[model samples]
Target: MDFSIILMIIGIVCVVVSFFLKDSSKKIEKDLEELSISIYQETNSLKRRLKVVEEELLLEPNFQVKSPLPNKTKSSINQSFQLKQTEAAPAKNVKPINEILVRQVIELKKQGYTLQEMIKMSPLSEEQIRYILTNNGGIQ
Candidate 1:
C-alpha cells in the first residue's frame, strides 16, 4: 500500500508540470503573433511613405527655365569674342620683310652672280631669289 501511494504522487506531479508547460507554449505563440503584426504594420507604413516621395518628385518644378535674350545665342557670343581679337590690321602701303629680302637678292644678282652663287653669298630665301630673277626688275 505504501509503494502504490508513492507511485500515485509521482504521476500527479508529472501531470501538473505538463499543464504548466502547455500554457507557457500558448503564451509564447501569442507573443510571436503580436510581433509579426507590428512588423507588418511598419512595413506597410514605409511603403506608403515611399509612394508619397515618388509623387513629390514627379510634381516638383524645375529651376532652369529658358528666357529670351539677345546675347544668349552661340553666334552672338562668338562674334563678340572675335571682334575683340581683331583690332583693324595695320595699313598696307609699307613693304613687307619678304619684299625687302627680294630687293637685296636682285641687287646682288645684277652684280653678275648666278643663283647657286647667290645661294652661297646671300642670306635671302630661295623663293626671294627666284622672285627677283623671275620678276625682271619689278619690285614685287
Candidate 2:
C-alpha cells in the first residue's frame, strides 16, 4: 500500500512539470515568430531608404551641402584680437631672478645656518628656501 501511494505522488509531480513546460514552449515559439517578423519589416524599410538615397545621388552627382561656420560675437572677436596683439608685444613687469640671493642662501646653509635664521636673512620664501635646501642635499 505504501509503495502505491509513493508512485501516485511521483505521477502527479511529473504531470505538473509536463504541463508547465508545454505552456512555456508554446509562448517561446510565438515570441520568436513575432521577433522574426519585426526584423524582416525593419530590413525592408532600411532597403527602401537606401535605394532612395542611391537614386538621389545618381540624379545629382555633384550635389554637396556646405556647413556654415559658427557665428562669433563682436566682443569675442575684439578679445581675440587683443589677445593676439598682447602675445606679439613684449611682456612687462617680469620678475628678475636675484642670483646673489640664491648664492647667499647656499652659502648660509653650508655654514650650518638654521632654516629660521636663513629665512630671516634671505628674500626667498620659507617654502622656496626649504625646497632649495632639500633638493641640494643640505637639509632633510
Candidate 3:
C-alpha cells in the first residue's frame, strides 16, 4: 500500500498488455505481406493479358471491298467471288511489323506525307500507319 508497490503493479500490467499487442502487430505485418504479394501477381497477370491483346490487334485479318455488279446472276456472282477469294488467299498472309517500319512511318508522318501517300510508299496498311502514328505521338 505504498506508492512504490502501486508503480510496480502498473508496470507489470503494462508488460502484459505489450505482449498481447506484439502478437497482433505480427499478424498485421503478415497480412500486409500477403496482400502485397497478391497485388504483384495480379499486376503481372494483367500485363501478360495486355500483351496478348496487343499481338491480336497487330495480326488483324485483311478485308477487300467488291464493287456491285449491274446485272449478274446470284449463282455466277457467288462462283466468281469464291474464285477471286481463293486467288487472293496469299495476300492475306500478314507479316509482323518491325520497329524500323514503325519508325519510318513516324518519320513519314512528321514529313507531312498524307496517310494515303504513306500507305502507298510503305508496305503497311492504312490502319497500321495510323496506329504507328498515334502510338508514337506523331499525330497532331
Candidate 4:
C-alpha cells in the first residue's frame, strides 16, 4: 500500500475509536451524576435525623406548668399542688432516667465527689451527672 493510503486508514481507525470512547464517557458521566444526587439526599436525611435527636436531648425534664386560676383558697391551693404534682409526674416520665443511677449520683454528690470523678465512676455522661446533681440540690 502507498504511505498516504496507510495514513488515511490509521486516521479513520482513530476517528472510529474516539466515537466509541465518547459514548462510554457519556455513560460514565451520567452514572457519576446519579451517584452524587443519591449521596446528597442521604446526607440531608442524616442531618434532619441528627437535628431531631439534638432537640430531644436538649429538652428539660423539670418544666413546671402554671395554674390558670388566680384565687388562693386552701382547697384551691391543695388542688393546685396536686395538679402541679400530676403535671410534673408526666414530665419526669418523658425523660426516663434510671432511678438507681439517679440515687447513685446523688450519693456521690453527697460524698463530695468531684464532677470529673463522678463521670469516671458512673456509666452516665458528664451532662447527665451534672443534671442529676443540679436537680437534686447538689453542687452545680
- Candidate 1's C-alpha runs over 4 A off are 1-4, 17-22, 63-140
Instruction: Write model 1 residue lDDT over 56-137, tens digit each, in one string.
Output: 6444422122323232332333343334334333342222223334445767767788888888876655644564566435
**Model 3 per-residue lDDT tens digits across residues 23-78:** 77779999999999999999999999999977765555321223232223323433
Query: Candidate 4's residue-wise lDDT over 51-83, tens digit each?
Result: 987665446433233433232332343354446
lDDT tens per residue, model 2, 17-130: 887775877799999999999999999999999999978755552344332312232234334434544665657422222333445677899899999999999876685566
Whole-model alpha-carbon lDDT for candidate 3:
0.64
Compare candidates 1 and 2 on lDDT and give the better one.
2
User: RMSD per prediction, one decimal?
Assistant: 28.1, 22.9, 10.8, 12.0
TM-score of every model versus the real structure: 0.37, 0.38, 0.43, 0.44
Q: Which ten residues in a row have the lowest lDDT in candidate 1?
A: 61-70
Candidate 3 lowest-lDDT run of ten: 62-71
TM-score of model 1 relative to the true fold?
Answer: 0.37
Better of 1 and 2 by TM-score: 2
Model 4 error, position 127 (Å): 15
Which candidate tops TM-score?
4
> Residue 76 in model 4: shift from native, Å?
22
